[model samples]
Target: KFTITDGRIARIETDTSAGDAVRLGPALPGLANVQSHAFQGAMAGLAETRGDTGDTFWTWREVMYRFLERLDPDMAQAIAAMGQVEMLEGGFTRVGEFH
Candidate 1:
């Protein structure tokens, strides 16, 4: 059995009586995403190809800049929401969004 205090697990012990115990399904500890550029999620798969010379970080930044140029507040909000949903689905309970 487990006891929760202040939204956290405080104690765990073996219980002989199961009559009043609550049954919960499988559970796993959540993960934390320390750095997240959630707005960039909208650019997924948009700059994955190599250029004629070679693929470089500058080229990626250019692509990202172009995307940002056309992104409005509504689009940014949608992208951020999508990213947060993806994070939660991947077991991230805490996020430190950079943008």
Candidate 2:
């Protein structure tokens, strides 16, 4: 259980007697998404084509750099917001963004 005050977290307490305290559906708050490259999510699955050379990690990294170069502030913010919303919808309460 958690307590909120003044729009901030105030306390958390565990009690065995409060059966309703336990969430049974779509529960969040305990979930975490570590190693999250949120901006990369926008470019997911776009680095799988074989070029003159094979799709090596080096090639992928170059592609990623190109992608980054094309990112404007608004696009970056929109993509990041999208990632955060997806994480929250997927039940993640915390995330570590690597951008």
Candidate 3:
């Protein structure tokens, strides 16, 4: 069993003990969501279609830079928080955020 508190696992018990009641459930390991540019989460599916010329990571970067030009600290934080929430809901316990 895995006991989580404050976004971390508090304890792991494989066998029941006498002092307290033991609860059994699937134990999930934390996962690091690597390779995420949190800023890109806001643009998911926005640039998937082929561009007039062509599109690739380079083109995507151009779009990303334009997006970053408008980001102040507060906007950045909000975007990061939203990304983290999405990662957590998607079963990621840790995030290796690139941006």
Candidate 4:
């Protein structure tokens, strides 16, 4: 465990002995969710249903753009908060929201 006091790291301790616990498992760094349209989480499965004759990235983008038109600052913040929460729950510590 480690504790930060004021502007510096103060105390550090370990529960087990030095060689008792070797690094065996994969060391996974926190994921950076780069390039996520924050508001799309709400609409993830919405377009998977029946749509026009052919549904492609362009078609999905059109739907996403329509959703974007409805969001203001507050809505955007709310969406970002929700997205961040979900990302953290899924082991992602940082997210790079792409507009």
Candidate 5:
């Protein structure tokens, strides 16, 4: 059993009766994203095209460089915020960002 206070887990114990406890189904620990380029999330689906060279990692690197050249601090923060929201919705409780 567990007790929540202020939207956080306050206590956890086993072999106790659940008295007036809310059942939220079987709970799984939230996952952590160990490696994330949050800024690159803003380019989702924008680099999937097959170029004349047939889409190599070099091509993608070039695209990313161009994107980064135009990204300012505010834009990076906004993209990171959006990525964080997406990560939470996707069941990530923590993130280790690469940028």
Candidate 6:
């Protein structure tokens, strides 16, 4: 909880009875995934395979590019939303998506 005064932060307090407080319910403290390729989150299960030459970074890149080719702006937005939701559920409140 907090008591603001004249548009500046004033008394800061933790209140058990705060009406709008979000209860974490045994969850760990939120963490940040500092290097997230959030777009990959959407294509997670689809790219966990090896190519004929065996998997490499180049192979993964190709798969990611293919995923992008089929993704329009709206689809990308939805996918990003899904990633954000997953991150939050996994106790990550902040992320830096590389895509």
Number of residue pairs clashing in candidate 1, backbone atoms closer than 3 angstroms, sequence gap of 3 or more or interchain:
0
Instruction: Indicate the worst ten consecutive residues by lDDT in candidate 3.
Output: 16-25
lDDT of each: 0.85, 0.80, 0.79, 0.75, 0.87, 0.78
Across residues 6-86, which tens digit of lDDT does each residue of candidate 6 receive?
Answer: 944467677556787555455244599988888887788876867577778888888889989998999989988998998
lDDT, ranked from best to worst? 5, 1, 2, 3, 6, 4
lDDT of 5 at 28: 69
Error of 5 at 90 (Å): 2.4
Between candidates 4 and 5, name the one with more favorable TM-score: 5
Ranked by TM-score, the better of candidates 3 and 4 is: 3
Find the 10 residues in a row with the least total lDDT in model 1. Answer: 12-21
Candidate 5, TM-score vs. the true structure? 0.82
TM-score of 6: 0.65
- Of 1 and 5, the candidate ahead on TM-score is 5
Over 4 Å off, model 4: 1-27
The alpha-carbon deviation from the true structure for residue 41 of candidate 4, after best TM-score superposition, in angstroms, is 0.2
Which candidate wins on TM-score? 5
Clashing pairs in 1: none
Q: Give candidate 6's whole-model lDDT.
A: 0.78
Instruction: Tell me the deviation in Å of residue 25 in model 2.
Output: 6.9
Candidate 2 lDDT over residue span 7-42, tens digit each: 545777776465555554542345898878988889
Cα lDDT of candidate 3 equals 0.79
**Which stretches of model 1 miss by more than 4 angstroms?**
3-27
